[model samples]
Target: MDRAQEGGINDVGIGALFGLVDYRFEILAIMEHARHLEEDYGCGPHTVSFPRIEPAEGTPFSQRENIPHPVSDKDFMKIIAIIRIAMPYTGIIISTRERPELRDQLVRYGVSQISAASETNPGGYDEEGDNTKAKPYEKTGSTGAQFTLGDHRSLDEVISMMIDGGYIPSFCTGCYRKGRVGADFMDLAKPGLIKEYCKPNAMFTFREYLEDYASPETKEKGLRLLKELTQTFPKEELKRRVEGNLCKIGEGERDLYF
Candidate 1:
């Protein structure tokens, strides 16, 4: 983290593989790490990820057969809940390694960031028909990936689900862009006033995505959902600002924020 900051990186994310050891011990260790960073650098982990072990295709059949310390669904939730309450201001990220149902449940357990779409292989995103594959790393021999992914939805599909789940799918990076970091970031997040800026910024970015990137069907649904969501914000002043900014966005104004 210190090296990254010295190299001009402003944010850092950290995590522990939960199933490798006693999860309770790992959580306390993570907390200690966060405190150490803050004491030394005036900033702590910007995000924390929790990933559990899973079976992969390229692993040895014998080792795969004898899995170690697999985390149960109930224990998973309890761990995340404890982390959430322990670090309310930190962004808790859940990856696509878990099934969709489990991912959905993690959102309610204080997960603020999620990997909706990801490709692990090299050149996975390109249109070229490259079929090159890499073997998973093993201490003794080549295997394959350490784990398999569970969620396979596209980004648009995930956004639609988020909307259905009453979450505003925000693409806002306003906090980091605006220099809110370390203690400053926590102040806004803890008091819940950050939403005053983030909500409107999210609407703008969602609008931009709908205009430029979304498929026709997705655009239609996103716009309709955006309209419905706007009505739920009862604060007149905030609503007015959001309305003005949204109109500007529609008029091709970019990066406008509260």
Candidate 2:
């Protein structure tokens, strides 16, 4: 994925490929696979996919063997190394299970995105911090209880913190909308077409955030940041597209990115 991004390919999204057993090994495999993708196929701007990793059914929380605990410093360093290698191009997104310390470490290592207040279950947010119903919905074929991290903050708090920390908490939803995926999309995206879609989408989402969620001070800061970013990129057509799309985002789509 790094190579693809470096080579100017922009459409690929790589999954984290996590599984049961050692998360250490899983992290290593993710790094290795990303490295291979960068070295060989030139996939760039990758997304680190998060699949639910849960203990087997009926296993009590205390006895759950495969659950991820806070990673040790050594393992954290390895994760950092992987992130640093991929940071030049790909976007790393860590899900909610990661401990606050680990999340801080990964942020230091250049993780670019995150999911805040995520629930695996449908309609889970309606309950809002209720752990019992936050479990994965049966319709989704998920069996384990839901998990929360980092004090189960509201979306506003998370985004506020993200902004204060100097990260772009993007709520982009372009890849699916743009019809850019699968094997065929990869070929056209090799020259950075995906970035064309993603950048504008990010800007629009940021704008929508300001319009809907920002406090006066946050809105001021966000606008300043947006102005600076626009200056850096300087693409009028893309700017226009972003403005147009911002209107399409429904009023109800509030807490998806946090």
Candidate 3:
């Protein structure tokens, strides 16, 4: 389990073998354990717990059971309630398997981040059209890789789509740097402690993309969006930081966020 967490496992981060099996009880235990860890040991920053909500094969969508499975609407609401009471600072990542309208509704109900154009397989990004190979590190006996549910897109495509959908495709990397991690970080984060760092970094990454990867039209659109967002905050200081970061990025800074 610790190995799984270190390897970037999440609710959606299933191994190839686990993906094929219907280990419903085991999955529930995992989710419950995560919840307990966050509540007792302060290990999670965002909502560390996830409900086992994926529907089983041959199950009718309308009659799906809640709890230890893809939660029913009522149970989902209950989960949110529990989260608010026990872990309000934690964020949820709603998978793409839900209906588009349902997914949108979840976003409104405090889902802080989402995956787009996600490929479960390690080389899936490079494979593009092929869908047969399992992700490099996925366990054996796993189901074959499955495509993302929404418009099949790459990260770039997803960013563009988010922009079109009137959302900021944030690449903020503040929490990791600020030493504000786990549930305790939430107390510091509640009043926007890290926004000071996050905003500048987000702008810096956005600016780098605008100047480098984006086409003139994309640059124009991104700039327009930036202008609108920046106007809401006094961002002169952030602008300076962004410029400095952009310079470092141009100088081949590797592993920087966008």
Give the number of the best model, judged by TM-score. Answer: 1
Residue-wise C-alpha lDDT for candidate 2, range 91-187, written one tens digit per residue: 6667776655566566767676776766554466553465345445556566444543433555666666766676666787666555555334555
Estimate the TM-score of every prediction.
0.82, 0.60, 0.58
After superposing candidate 1 on the true structure, give the runs of residues whose Cα lies further than 4 Å from its correct spot.
2-9, 61-64, 127-146
lDDT accuracy of residue 108 in candidate 3: 55
Query: Which lDDT tens digits does candidate 3 get at residues 127-229?
Result: 4445444354455544334422443444455456556666665666656665556444655655557566566567666666666666666667777776676
lDDT of 1 by residue, 12-112 (tens): 88889866778888889989888887787767788989988766655553243455566788999998999888877688998888888888878888888
Give candidate 2's whole-model lDDT: 0.59
* Cα lDDT listed for each candidate: 0.77, 0.59, 0.52
Q: Candidate 2: which stretches are off by over 4 Å? A: 1-24, 31-46, 50-70, 83-91, 120-123, 127-144, 183-193, 234-258
Candidate 3 or 1, higher TM-score: 1
**With candidate 3 superimposed using the best TM-score fit, by how many Å does residue 136's alpha carbon deviate from the native?**
14
Model 2 steric clash pairs: 4-42, 4-43, 5-44, 16-49
